[model samples]
Target: MLKLVQLYVYDLSNGLARQLSLQLTGKQIDGIWHTSVVVFGREIFYGQGISITHPGQSHHGNPLRMVDVGQTDIDEETFEEYLTEMRQHYTADKYHLLDFNCNSFTNDVVGFLTGGSIPDWIKDLPSDFLSTPFGAALRPTIDNMFRRPIPGAVSTPATIQPTPQSARAAINASPDPALASTLLQSVASQATLGPSSMAPPSQSTSTVAAPVHICTNPTSFHNTLKTHRAVVAFFTSATCGPCRMIEPLFDQLAHEKTEAAKLAGGIAFAKIDMGVGMGGMVGSEYGVRVTPTFIFFLDGIKKHEMKGANRAELTSQVNMLLFEAYPPHPHSKVTIPALEKVSTNPILFTQVPKLDIVTTKLCSFVDSASRPIPNSQTIKHTLSSEFAGYLRGQFSSNGKAVRSSATPQMLTKWTETTKTLVGHLPPSQLFPLVDMWRLAILDNVVSSWCATAAGNMTDPIQILIVKALSTLRSSEAPSTMRNYILTTLRLLSNTFSDLTLAHHVLSPSGKRSSVTSLVITTLLHEDASVRTAASSLAFNMAAAIQKVRIEQMRAMNGSVSGLDEDGEWEIELVSAVLEAIRNEVQNEDIVHRLTASLAFLLRLSPVYESQLAPLLEVLQAKETLQSKLEKGGCGEQGVQNNDIRSLIAQVAESLLVHMAWDNTRGGGIQHKTYRDCEQCTL
Candidate 1:
């Protein structure tokens, strides 16, 4: 009781017809037939008919010319030629009339022909077309054709059933189900099989876990290891605050996740302590200027990477990879739909929710230093307390208790809000907020907080706060506050001097006293590290001053014969400072500062040897110089006016002796023999 099936072959050709003949009868068909019936079991299958006629002819012209066809038309003679050519090109046994398209047609045709009773051809088709040898080879080619509907066509029963299965099989075979799902989900609703149901069981097991080996150095991991299925490497540093925040998350992931734990077996997780291990060489190798960079490897080969402190982003990427490796069960009751196929008008995906939290935290730390406090007392408080109340609102300790965190963005909002708050306060109270920021530079915790804040604040006022503290000039600040100021200023100035207000302060006359005080204090500071910082700052200041002077001199060169009086005054000031420095060069702390400063000066202005000669003389004459160096009882411990006056006379005498030699013209007693007589010592 086999049923007759209508086979609608599309874009049919002689190749398809011959393939069908061989598949059905195991014998090659020799000639073309316009309409034909093939019998398999007790069923009869009819292919679509084709008729060829002369051009411009009505239904009947010279006689209806019958052409070879399965579903589409072909000329009778052309069909015969095609058969001959295929027979010549392909061996008799190798040639088949049916490729994948015809084979698909056969399955449906057999099913219909048998009246829903499975035909021999239907029974012969592979149970799992995706895994079958023939299905694997031909499934992709068939799938592509079925995705787009044929133009100017209506769906027929035969076309509807076969097309979708082929298309779905191709999608299921892809390596990345997420990517494949993304592509296939659009048409998935129309599909008989839902997305979740199609996924194989292997895709369900991948979950990211803790890393195995914590390599202090990644290069060592690369050097030591030979083969690994996957490797996760983290680049971090101890001083990087963001790294500190993210390290716990990375540790937690490595410790708990099965995949990360077994990474050593097939995957390996490694870490690079950029501060100590690689000397930051690995960072350069990986183009990681920032901390908390994660790199993923497969078979010890790098495949993916991300940088930043967002734990969720890292986790999302890890989860995506894990699911890809171990897909959800295809037959599972719980299923996730495949992603939709792409369209020109694609739907945009919103970013995950957790990113906002991460951004808030990062922004909070960046602007922490510049944020104005409510009062002076707040400065003495611990950082956790200053922002504790704020933290209570932003985070949840156990998903049940919501807390606020003083993030940079929140702080910025607070700053804006506080402007209104300040309006209610007396004008006298306004300056105290600025003072708090100044005080923050001293307390290590506050200083670190400020440093973190500097990284986040976008508002000009917040930026200015960081800039001011960074460039704080010793002379512009009150003397009582100067010591604390220098220490805080040193902390910032040593590392971020280029961005600090200290550089700008050195450029102006009004601020020069502050600059001078800073330099002097640095040179006299008891701490070796502080002395070093002061010396460095002094060098930077001197270089800046020299540059300004050079530019001014260049501008005035042809216009004036003598040096500008203002310029001369600046030089004199510099010389006086130099003299003061030279007088104190014997103090061990000051000596290092002076030597470093002098070296910087020598490098900066080598041509000013004559101008610098006196300072050099004092330095060179250390033993006598120290003995003669008198403290002016002026609270400052260095040379005073009397010391300067005596040194100048000694210099003048030296000049006079030289002048006398020149006047003598190589002979006779010098008119004035300048000598340091015992009376001068008195």
Candidate 2:
């Protein structure tokens, strides 16, 4: 069920007293100083304080007025967690009248939960007022005075209104009609969510993998030929030094062609390395045993061939053939490096205990009688000893080994149960469901499924999870739910990147899973938690890609350039992360994750060498610009004591170390993790 939102506005005083205060304070807006967001039916309120208080009981008494701010789909548990996280930044001890205050907190909470911020007039009022000369002059005293709440109000929700709204009318709908109309014209959207966020759960799911044809499968290859695209076969030998030498370039072309072929149908490359089994079959089929040979096929007909290491000739022929057979694509448009062949190793998922005892106990934790997810309440109604014993049976390890009770079917049912309760259940209750699923994946369920089911022609783990995600992604996900999803995606990608081989990552259907798409979307999500998780996932992906690429390069000797593609996902991942960080300047929480992501991404060279140095130069320029603005805006204190300035300095320092490492390579950063800057002691 969608929840209701209420914006509680408090006025400092009424009539001319309001005008007098603004006059003395030297601001256009009257003394509507404090705001609290009340989740009406839930009896929950969230506002800034030294800490969060439950039941919406605290603040400047009952608000003078409550404005309906539309509805939000966030469950109570989700909102509670959101409020909890908000308090970490806007804590009671940290509150400042001008900077971190009650009103600012409300706007953030309202914006995150509902997607629209509080009224623009109210949201901007404080910032605008503080920017004024008169308001600026008195800021220091106000900051000191309101650093902490008054002793009495800190503990108990104040029943008394701290200020009055009588003077509010004088300035609002006041004696002056013109001023009143302008100030009272509420600035808000029809709804904060975009049309897409409101889009109903889609019946459509892109579970089908993309296709690529292999050499042994002439049927698949024959079918691919129907597209009239050019296919290049690079026949190489294990003993041939030159074959290894040109292999990276050929592989690079293959990766680029794979992408290019998708949009414009230009070309595709298939590795026919005699050292690998498939290459021998192709070599024999073509009556060619020579290493370093390039065979081009267009419309199922062999059109051309290149022998020896005439690199220029091979490249030129393939280029011409591809252009003629398929539309040309400037894949060099985003030139980085190309990916190696997919690894044949199965991405074995790690496994763990089901811990049935804990899960069964949690079944009764929520007040089920109140029923959060309307259609689902059976688990809440029945606390049967029999069910508890059954759950316990799944976890019993007594002297003997406990037999596994967790299966794909069981997990699927559990997921369906949890998902149905998502909007209906509070976030606190919902997180456990996500955790349970994650553990199931960790306990080798994920790996087992990927091996047996994911690559299968039929639906199994991938389809089931994709359908579940479809349900999860269909609505305006509450912050907690989004947080859970982001965390899950991060975990999944991190594991997949680590354990899954390149071949295993590819589906038999000739396409890649939509997992990357999921991560990218969340990386750019409106929610900061999701973005943070996505950034962290990128870091893991880059590391995994680099590890595998390095391993492959090592096996190939010095033939391929030391650089294979810098992790398949890093280039795009870093680009997205950088864009988000650049856009969300006010969100201080994102900086740490962005800096961490950049640190890891910078570990990949050529790409890192190309990108990091210029980034340092840009960071230096930004620092200089900010230093100038702050000095110009509010004197030395503004320049010296600013949060953004401080954060900027830290980010620059972090990037500086990376640039230094980039220039020096790994010599300076050895044994130095991100936490202990290469220059700093561990």
Question: Which one wins on TM-score?
Answer: 2
lDDT of each: 0.36, 0.45
What does candidate 1's lDDT look like per residue over 1-682, in tens digits? 3222332222122333243322211223322221211332111111111112223132211212322123313333543443332222122111112221223223322322232222333222322222222233334443332332244444221122333554443333222223333423322222111122221211111121213443333334553244444456788776789887887777666654432222223334566666643326666777877778887765555667898988898877655544433222111111112101111121111112232343343234333434544542332232234433333333324566554423334344444433432333322223333332333333222222232221112222234333333434434434444444444334334322321233224423123444455455445554545455565556555544444333433332211111112333344444544554554433433433333333323322423323444454444433333433445212245444453434433422322111112246436533322233222211
336-375 per-residue lDDT for model 2 (tens digits): 2111222223232233335454455456544562555443
**What's model 2's lDDT at 367?**
51
Give me the overall lDDT of model 2.
0.45
TM per candidate comes to 0.23, 0.34
State each model's C-alpha RMSD to the native.
31.7, 31.6
Query: How much is the lDDT of residue 468 in candidate 1?
Result: 36
**Model 1 regions more than 4 Å off:** 1-483, 499-503, 509-513, 525-533, 543-589, 602-682
